[model samples]
Target: MARRVLLWVGDEAVHEAAGRVLHSVMDAQRAEELMRSYGEQLIERGRQQGREEGREEGLSRGRAEYILRTLALRGVHADEAARERILGCTDVATLDRWFERSLNATTLSEVLDDLAQ
Candidate 1:
């Protein structure tokens, strides 16, 4: 019943306060078990979120690299600042758009002209 009620609570602060209240009223051993279990769950959730974020960063990095390499192979001259701008971008959609532009671009401006607007 307590677990169900805790799940129903939308606010994290309120949920945590309710957990503390429940812990105070429970027997020591039971409270300890609840704490340990919830603690493990929270740690796992954090780890999962980190892994997901890392995966997204890696994907964006790969896309950026591909765009840079494509421009080089096509003989489009990108200056140091242009290289940095491409490498620094982390948004997948924006990288994809740039990559598409690079496929037929004859100059750096052709690939990144949208940024000027």
Candidate 2:
């Protein structure tokens, strides 16, 4: 009579040989929780970026409006369309130049000259 020997392997071998044998160990709820957590982190990052962009836009618009008002007081007429165009401009350096021009500009031509410069 001959004696027979049996071989034993770990979980990795078992998983590789067949499909998952411990499917019950991880449930759907845990997976859902992990996905939800990742989504929340992405949303927070987007919100932070949006807030920074909004603050920059607000500051730019305020500066443009101030320049327009100053020009108006100096007897330079800026119609609603022109004011809107000025406010829509995002170039900070241009806005600063316009602000300086507004200080000494007595006519629309002077203000327009600053823009050309």
Candidate 3:
């Protein structure tokens, strides 16, 4: 079919047009591949970030619960304000310090004293 078209169109013009069409198709395919690759990478990055956020939330929540339980076991009664502060804290380092203090504290004030500093 191209041979017949080349004969009718003149060989030089037909070949140049054919070359342009081939180049355009190749460029289109290349563009599609690049977009697909970038899209996949973006999706994977989002999923990984979501996983990290979930892990951090779980750690904070678990640490808060442990702090409360440890205080109860040690007979250190956390008042309502102290309880809310401890439960609402999202910093793992602060929770860890509070947990350490709770193990030896006789009162809620003793457990949370460092937070005032």
Candidate 4:
């Protein structure tokens, strides 16, 4: 029987092997705990990044809308291409400058000028 063979090998040898196995199991459990903690931190960081990107995108959309509305209220007729350029803009300062120009613009081109820059 396997028990008889193990007994014949003596108690000292059996105890040493059993101790090694206990240590190996403990080490494996500690490594697993550390991995789980690290994974949670990475997930939190990804979520934070997503929120920041969403906020920035919303700001850009708001700026673009403000620019278009200002042009319309001033009776400036921006064609389709000019409308696209205004709506597509994301730079807040540049959008503000264009909105200011719209107040004094007699033609769509005046408000949309320097847009290529």
Candidate 5:
């Protein structure tokens, strides 16, 4: 029940406070063990979330770079502002669209035409 309540609260500070209270009231060694277990679980969850976020960020960056490379190969000159727009974009679908456009685009304007809509 206490574990359920802590999980339901879903706050790290609350969990720490609860662990402290449990330690004060329960057998010190047992409480310490439980706290360690909970802390490990929390750390693992954080690491997993970080890994997922990093992977998504990498995918976004790779797509953006590929789009830029494709534009360069097609002889479409992207000015500084356009380059920033492409690099800053996090939407994979938009990047894919831009890449498809670059395949046949004769100018930077043509590559970014959908953005105007």
Candidate 6:
């Protein structure tokens, strides 16, 4: 005598449906393939985000350094403490105004004034 299996599709019970359709399927191998594909996709997305973050950091540092160098050329002398303050600033609009004033600022006070506004 053969064994029988029943599966409920909607409102009717179908006999031997799974045994007839999925009798030769491999479940473990298919699951492993899907897991590996998902891991690779996650790693690629993380790398792209890291690269973009690094690019933004480098641009901000470069702009800050340019402002300091321009201030030095214009005879605006800032000590180590003031230099640290300027480099720590992250606002782009404020930095742009400071950069413009650095070209003509004759004293450190004038440079700080531009940064304040």
- Among these predictions, the greatest lDDT belongs to 1
Residue 29 in candidate 5, Cα distance off native in Å: 1.1
Best-fitting candidate, scored by TM-score = 5
What C-alpha lDDT do the candidate models reach, one value each? 0.84, 0.68, 0.75, 0.69, 0.83, 0.64
lDDT of 3 by residue, 29-85 (tens): 764554455456656778999999999989988898899999999887777888889
Runs in model 5 deviating more than 4 A are 1-8
Evaluation by lDDT, superior candidate among 2 and 5:
5
lDDT of 2 by residue, 4-97 (tens): 1101222555533322322244565754554355456556778999999999999999999899989978888987777787889888888888
Positional deviation of residue 11's Cα in model 1 after best superposition, in angstroms: 9.5
RMSD of 1: 3.0
Evaluated against the true structure, the overall lDDT of model 3 is 0.75
For residues 14-114, could you state the per-residue lDDT of candidate 5 as single tens digits?
87789889888899998888777776777788899999989988998998888889889988888999999999988888888888888888899887876
| Model 5 steric clash total | 0
| Segments of candidate 2 deviating more than 4 angstroms | 1-30, 114-117
Instruction: Give the per-residue lDDT of model 1 (tens digit) for 8-100.
Output: 565889967877887789987887777566666667778999999999989988998899899999999899999899988988888999999
Order of quality (lDDT):
1, 5, 3, 4, 2, 6
Between candidates 1 and 4, the one scoring higher on TM-score is 1
Candidate 6 structure quality by residue, lDDT tens digits, 1-117: 012122122223242343334344546565445435544555676798899987876777777788899887876778898788788877777777777777788887776664446
**Candidate 5 overall Cα lDDT vs. reference?**
0.83
Model 5 Cα displacement at 11 (Å)?
A: 2.9
lDDT of 6 at 42: 55
The C-alpha stretches of model 1 lying farther than 4 A from their native spots are 1-20, 115-117
Per candidate, the number of residue pairs that clash is: 0, 0, 0, 0, 0, 0
Candidate 4 local lDDT, 4-58, one digit each (tens): 3433434666745744554575686754554455455556777999999889778
CA lDDT for candidate 4: 0.69
